[model samples]
Target chain A: MIPIILFLAPALAMALFIFRSKKLNAVVICLYSFTHLACSVTLLVHPASYGRYFQVEPLNLFFLVVLSVVLAGISVYNADFTLKSAVPARKSTYYSAAVLVFSAAISGVVLGANLGMMWVCLETTTITGAYLIYYKTGKEPLEAAWKYMFICSIGIAFAFVGLIFLSLAFTGSQPSLFFTDINAHAPVFNKFWLKMSFVFMAIGFGTKAGLAPVHTWLPDAYSEAPSPVSALLSAALLNSELLIIIRILKIMKIADLGGFASAFLITMGVLSVFVAAVYIIRVGNYKRMLAYSSIENMGLITISAAIGGPAAFAAVLHIAAHAFSKASLFMTSGNILKRYYTREINGVTGLLKADPKAGWSWIAGFILLCGIPPSPIFLSEFIMIRTMFGRGMWWLAVPVMLLVTIVIYGMASTMFKMSFGNPQKGISQERFNILNYAGQFVFIAVLCLLGIYMPKAISDLITAAASLM
Target chain B: MTEVLIAIFGITMLYVSSTSRVEAYIRVLAVQGVILFLMVLLDHAHLEVLNLVFLGAETLLFKAIIIPVFLMFTVRKNNIQREAEPFMPSFYSVLITTAIFAFGFLIAFWASSNASNVRPLYFGVSIATIITGLFIIISRKKIITHVMGYIMIENGIFMLAMSVVGEMPMIVNLGVLLDLFAAIYLLGLFVTKINSTFDELHIDSLTNLRD
Candidate 1:
């Protein structure tokens, strides 16, 4: 089955990482990404061959495509990122292994028909990411890694406990925990236990997804990780966690508990946006600021998912747009970090003058991130707001619109401060690798095109995916 | 027979909490593994024979023997005898752990009204043990003791699962057990690294990043 490749490509890549040269690892990752991308496209066009445990539903197919594309982009960028590494030998193996492991894990989460299997993959991703987060091996990275493990491990443990509670809700026949079986029989589950399970799962997985109130680990982990890892964490890893929550959301829909589940999600979603917006304005680290921005976007998706109906459409679109834009932004941030040799907001200036490619990418990324015109994120945000207003939930739209505005202002201010000002004297002129520039260019180009238009096949996939939800 | 094994499981945590010696904590984990293996054999009469054998061997080999061997290696490698610098005083930790155990017992008793569905005693003692394990994790300062606390929590979870879902598939059980062991091994290795890096096992030193 194609799903086997989806899982194995990464595992094999990890093994190869241990033995192969750095150049070989890069080629392998690129090959895996291409293979993964090709399989996802084929799966989207013809769904018959897809296995039950690893079917490519339209929504997941969209995510698969985004994941593969971003990974491929990161792979190319990684070729250069590795060169800039002050400590290459010790760090490269871990980085490659993480990519391969994270890819397999993400694909597994996206495609898994069994909840228990998906949980395993999600937990596996968390463990694999530990190396990536601790790559720097500095005081900050170590601290970040510890918090990342402890918090995520506990959160995932809670998710397992939720799985047990969900299993407890079954009454007749052998109690099944597979997603397909659970969905089919969800309507008959004991309401009390089902709701309790949902609460626990939402909080548990939400922590991994970087949803607010439980998102304390995100800023530290994302800020401290190497840029490419930050990109993966923000763009790909979080989506898999979201996929887990979406699986439960599907169950809620099947059980006709949408009303209850939606209420809970809306509360968390709005809180995430408000908290992120407040934090974004004054973040000291540029990477942490972007991390906060990611939290806000994820919050938007959550709120949109809670709205259901057409809003699910918006949620899917926003997820895609956010993936591309945020990946581009984080990758470009890596460029800035390499050039400036510092992540502090005050340490670097005149980004445009120093390196136009990285600087413009930063600006363009911010524009896309803030939902500026012609960007897919803007289109998605528009649709989400319209969906809310059309449903006569004008009150719900208020905080979303207000928080987004504040976020826009905050991001704009940060970009302005970092981009246009005079370059600090005595700043060393660093050589930007051609491979890095090409990767960023490819990423930004893809993002721009996706914003302006989506290919019909992908759009159809998105529509079908939304209908399933 | 399972009841006796499960009771020993609960008592092990009390011993783990009251002790300052990290080596004793590792020993208690080995004893708990033996207790769990016996408990599984005595209680899971509904499980397939092959699964029971597999579970029995796994608990005996990995849980009882292999993991404890690794922890002992880590113990010897680090040369850490006692985690004498607990975050809280021993007396306070003991009192807090006792209170948590009592609260867990109350929860189990209150929730286990369906007598035929699950055993009240199994639920009560397992919950108490889990809470006490968590108490150890919180009150201990050393990473080694933290790992022991994690193992204790895992054991308590395994007992709870055995009590409630006696007929879990072999694959699920194996995966759960393997994952927990891997987590403990990784955490233990990290503790050693932390010890070597900083020359102290105190978790407080890992607090450099903040808003």
Candidate 2:
């Protein structure tokens, strides 16, 4: 029943959109989002109702749940955002419908039992995401949308070729692309083809994951996109891309190619963080700053997850912590953008004095993002650092800590300057709307709660999900 | 017959590499599409009726007919100048493309040494075509030409997928076709949108959002 609703709801939304029943869209969005979250929570106990094409196992269970949670928050936020924004009626309807499609596609990417199905779902996310990125349709948005569309599509297309190469590793007439089956028989697959396949996919899926070398489209898309879309892309879409890469890396693990995959992963991971570190300081726009931070966090996740053991557990915690915090920050940045009409760091001033809720949320989000104490990111980073030492990876620890420090300092200095200054003349205080800050506050509260006291069940789930590596 | 179709398919990349005219590129894409449909049909002569229909729709209807027509419409509608205005000289592009093709054959020779279910010629040609498609993208300046490069890469990838005898599930095949269609369709839409928004349809105009 859950899977049915999950799959059918998008089509229903599209139908409604086509019929011009754009009213009640906010309620429709909220109802469908609850169904999505409920379905993910339900799948924690029961396997998916649709088992052939989509499956739910421990590896994907937590990812699915996090996606739903982040998306649910985004959905609530988007409902408020759409209702209040001065966007024309038809445009808002299209936005709502596109969001539904994007939701389904990301869900599909998480639940795909077959590798090919995952590839398809991953590409669909790009198409829908481009729409959201291009929502404003101005010069910057158009350019961002174009680059995002071209690069990611070409990346996924190469991934499809990689899929074919993976099939070539098998000698049979019909190669099974089932994820579990591939993982099981990975040892027997041809090493040459498997290595080739991984190279293509690393470049391919890495583009989506915001890894260095292929991460150029990310900052543009993130900054140009409406805040909610940025939230969704950072929180949900990236995790889905990482899920597939994690599965592929598992194949490498089973095939005795763990070192190769890990070396490749760490290189990209380090480079991503290094790149983000360099750019975060030099970048002028605050939203692009958030985008670079996402790249850095993704780098951190990949590095620790590659290291395995307790660090992998920490990585999962980091994924959740980063998702909600980044979502909060980006959306709050939207609030900041609306208040000031500028994304430039120097252009806007006195955020705290003007709108206290958004201002505080912005600072809290920055705190969580930079891994301050009492934020779950602090706990995750602590575990990663401990594992780095215990495993005799003291060399990796230096760069990791250094780049992390750079990132925090860069973001913190910008955040403080924006938060503390006096407002420019002609600034008017808009009516306080709880919806704008509601999702962000809730996420911050959850992260704080997790940091102070991690629940046993949630810990168990993260542990189990981490063990799949 | 299969080798001949594949040979003509590989040769199409040579023309695309050497040509600067957008109309010629569109025609060559159409030719490659027909050749792909023929090659796939020949490879899987004993396929089921359902599979045959899908292959025909994906390769013949969409790839050959619809996509070419759409590209043509975009070209005419945008009033784009005929020259693709590639970043490199045509002579250099032809040389590089040929070298890449030679490299592909060398790889095929090496890969054939292993025990695998691959058609060496088909595999080699498709790899070269894919590389050449990428080369076209990097060496070209026009956004429309970039879309052509994307379409070429798709064709090359499709051919590569078909080169091996292994069968992906029909559902995945459907997914691939649908995605390809949506991507190209969206590319067409954006080409028109970008064309109107900017003075020239060149990639240089797209540098506004860079960090």
Interface RMSD of each: 2.8, 2.1
Compared with the true structure, model 2 gives a TM-score of 0.96
For model 2, the superposed segments whose C-alpha errors exceed 4 Å read A18-23, A47-49, B169-172
Number of backbone-clashing residue pairs for each candidate, in the order shown: 0, 0
DockQ of each: 0.34, 0.58
| Candidate 2 chain A least-lDDT 10 residues | A15-24
DockQ score for model 1, please? 0.34
Query: Compared with the true structure, what per-residue lDDT tens digits does model 1 show for residues A162-275?
Result: 776677667564667677789879988766657867987998899999998889899999999988889889989988888778879889878889899989888888989999
Q: Candidate 1 docking category?
A: acceptable
Candidate 1 wrong stretches, greater than 4 Å: A7-11, A14-19, A48-51, A83-91, A389-395, A454-456, B14-24, B72-76, B79-81, B84-86, B89-95, B102-116, B127-132, B171-175
- In order, candidate lDDTs are 0.78, 0.85
Q: TM per model?
A: 0.92, 0.96
Model 2, C-alpha of B176: deviation from truth (Å): 4.5
Positional deviation of A455 in candidate 1, in angstroms?
A: 4.8
- Name the best candidate (by DockQ): 2
